[model samples]
Target: MKRKSTLSRSTTETEISLSLNLDGSGIAQINTGVGFFDHMLTLFTKHGKFDLTIDAHGDEADNHHAIEDIGILLGKAFYDALGDKAGINRYAFQFTPMDEALCRTCVDISGRSYLVFDVPLTREFIGDFETEMLEEFFIAFTSNSKMTLHVASLYGKNNHHIVEGIFKSLGRTLKDACSIAAGNTEIPSTKGIIE
Candidate 1:
């Protein structure tokens, strides 16, 4: 099956168009006006080996709205594309290092949504992107996608490296979690349904 989704979300605060291909090679075309955020999203796409494209326009002064909305749409797309949870790994984890930073991420495609993010950064802002916005993004993502996600920074001194590691780890973890097991027809959950 083609595991892909295309979505658009619009509000008074932001307008976003996004597409994701879970089974594609690493390729990304992203534009958010916020250069740092775009770079992070690019890293995430490459590490996940997913094809992704995002075009976003929002209140340029405050990026929170666009970022959060993108996360929400991306998560919803994942949910819509997955169709059934059959034969998937369903759970995965990854440890990624970027320079002096070390971060770990764990993901489970549970029907219940929860997020535990503890990746601390030394700086409050990275270019136009506010570090606090990452939490908001993840909260919306997990809630919309109905997945459980946990992120922890084992060690980090630079804000960029820390955040980079977190995003990369999250991408790789999700890629693994969503991968289908060849020829396995059963869902991973014992409850017989994810939701």
Candidate 2:
């Protein structure tokens, strides 16, 4: 069965729709009124080899609601696409380097929500996207998806490179965690189930 999901959300804060295909050829169509975010998501999709499309509209004065809502929807999409978590690797890690930046991302689809982010921020904003909002996004993602994610920046001077590396590494880590494990089709957990 092909793993895919489409989801939408509408509220006073934001309105957004997203489609995700876990098995795809790295195609992304994203618009959130945040240029840097769009670029990051494109890179993430390409690196993860997933097809994703998103259209979001939020308060023009701020990007908080938009980014947070996107995170929620994206996490729900992943959870829906995984659907039982059978045969998946369930755990993965990656270290990505972009120029002088080195970032590490590790993930576990353990049906438990947790996040540990320690990426060093060099500035307050990378373009219109607030660097501080990255944590908020990941927190929502882990909570909604019921997963554990740990991201850290070992070292980086440039904020762009650091953030970019984090996104890229996270994409790769998730791709590995979500992939089927060898020829095993049983639940990846020892308890005979996940969550």
Candidate 3:
């Protein structure tokens, strides 16, 4: 069973298309206009070992629209790809350290959307990307995907390292949550359904 999703949105401001695969080798082609943000998304897909292709064009005057919309589309794609959530692990957590930075992420595909982000950056910007936008992206993702996601930086002084650690941990945690468990055919819930 191959799960794939394509999403497109157009307004007076921007137009975007995103395609995603729940199970795939680490391959990504992303163009979101913002170089740093695109790089981050690439790292996300590669670390998660998921195939992702995004083609986005937004108001060049404003990067916020494209960035936020991409998060929205990606979250919806995940929600669509999981389908009934049968035979899946449904919950995962990971702690990863990069250099002196340590970050942890926990996720639950519980059909309920919630986000708890505890990353505090010493700098206001990582390249051209604002540190605060990371929270915006996570909120967009969790709200659309209907999943509970918590990311915390246990220790980190460098802003770049802290954010990188968080993204990598999130990718690994998502990978585990979306994986199919052998010998388990039922949805990973006693309620018999996940929303």
Candidate 4:
């Protein structure tokens, strides 16, 4: 069966829609009114090899709401698509490098929400995207998805490279964590259920 989900949410701050497919070939179309943010999400989907589409609009007065809301919607989409999390690897970790930057990310779809981020960008901004919002996005994502995620940037001088490395590593890690193992159609947890 195709593992897919579509989610939508609206508030005074933003309106968003998200669609995701766990088993797909890294195709993504995203628009959040933040160009750099959209680029990062595209890279995420491409690296993860997951099919995703997002449409988001928010009060441009502050990009924070739009970015965070997108994260929440995307996380919800993943949770909805995974259903009971049966027959999945359920854990993944990866260390990736982008030029001078080295980043690592780990994930567990354990029906528990946690985010540990240890990245510090040398620069204050990456284009129009505030460097700080990256944390906000991940925080929103992990909280909504109920997944344990840890991201660390071992070393990086450039903020852009550092952020890119983290996002790509995260995508790859999540992809591995959500993959279905052969001949295993039951939840991988010893509890016989993820929740």
Candidate 5:
């Protein structure tokens, strides 16, 4: 069975529709009115080897609601796609580098929501995307997806490179964590029930 999901969310600030195919070749169609964010999401799909589509409209004046809503909807789609998480590897870690930036990402589909983001993005904005909103986006995603995620930029001088590395590493981590392990029919937990 293919693991796929589609989700839509509408609010006073934003409206978003997202689809995800966990087992797929990397292909993405994303539009969020934020150019940098679009680039990041595209890389996320490409690096993770997941097919993804996102269409979002929001209060362009602020740009925060749009990105945050996209994160929420995308997280919901991932949760829906995984279903019971049977036979999943369930944990993965990755490090990705871009120029002088090296970022690490770790994921645990443990049915618990947690995020530890230590990316030292001191700038206020990277192009049109707010640097602070990176944390906000991940917070929304991890909470909605019920997954524990850790993202840290070990060191980087360029904010853009740092953020890009973080996203790409996260994509790789998720791709590995969500894979179905061979000959495994049980949940990846000692409690026998995940979530």
Candidate 6:
């Protein structure tokens, strides 16, 4: 079964179009106006081994709307692609290190949505992209996707490394969570249903 989805989201603040393929070779074509955010998305796709495409237009002066909306759209794409969540691992975790930064991410593809983010950046801005927006993005994603996510930066002196590690770890965890096991016809839950 091919797991893929395309989404178009438009609001008074932004317009976003995105495509995702769960089984892919980590190819990404992204243009989100915010360079740093785009870089993070690229890393996410690459590390997750997923093919992704995104085109977004939003309030350039204030990037929070665009970033958060993109997260929402991306989350919707993941949920739609997964369909009934049959035969999937449904849970995953990863720890990644970049230079002095160490980050961990855990994901559960549950029907309920929750997020616990404990990343502290050393700086406030990464090339005009406010670091605080990262949390907002993840909040939007988890809430819309109905997935539980936990992200933490264990140790990091550099802001870029910390953020990059988190994104990369998130990608890897999602990849594992979404993978289907051989001969596993049932959902990976004891309750017999996921969401």
For model 1, the local distance difference test gives: 0.90
After superposition, candidate 3 runs with Cα above 4 Å error = none
Question: Measured by TM-score, how close is model 1 to the native structure?
Answer: 0.97
Q: Model 3, range 101-165, lDDT digits (tens) per residue?
A: 99999999999999999988778778888778889989999999999999999998888888888
lDDT of 2 by residue, 1-195 (tens): 779999999999999999999998899999988999999999999999999999999987689999999999999999999998899999999999999989999999999999999987969899999988899999999999999999999998999999999999988999999998668789988898987
Residue 15 displacement in candidate 5 (angstroms): 1.1
lDDT of 4 by residue, 88-139 (tens): 8999999999999999999999999999999987666788887888899999
Per-candidate Cα RMSD to the true structure, in Å, reads: 0.9, 0.9, 1.1, 0.9, 0.9, 0.9
Superposed by TM-score, candidate 3 places the C-alpha of residue 58 at a distance from the truth, in angstroms, of: 1.8
How many steric overlaps are in each model, in order? 0, 0, 0, 1, 0, 0
Instruction: Give the TM-score of each candidate.
Output: 0.97, 0.98, 0.96, 0.97, 0.98, 0.97
Compared with the true structure, all predictions reach lDDT values of 0.90, 0.93, 0.88, 0.90, 0.92, 0.93
Off by over 4 Å in 1: none
Candidate 6 per-residue C-alpha lDDT over 1-195 given as tens digits, one digit per residue, 9 for 90 to 100: 889999999999999999999999999999999999999999999999999999999975699999999999999999989988999999999999999999999999998899999987767799968899999999999998899999999998999999999989999999999999988879778898887
Off by over 4 Å in 4: none
2 or 4: which has the higher lDDT?
Answer: 2
Off by over 4 Å in 5: none
Lowest lDDT block of 10, candidate 2: 181-190
How much lDDT does candidate 5 score?
A: 0.92
Q: What's the C-alpha lDDT at position 125 in model 1?
A: 93
Worst 10 residues of 3 by lDDT: 59-68
Q: Please give the distance, in angstroms, between residue 93's alpha carbon in candidate 5 and its true position after superposition.
A: 0.2
Off by over 4 Å in 2: none
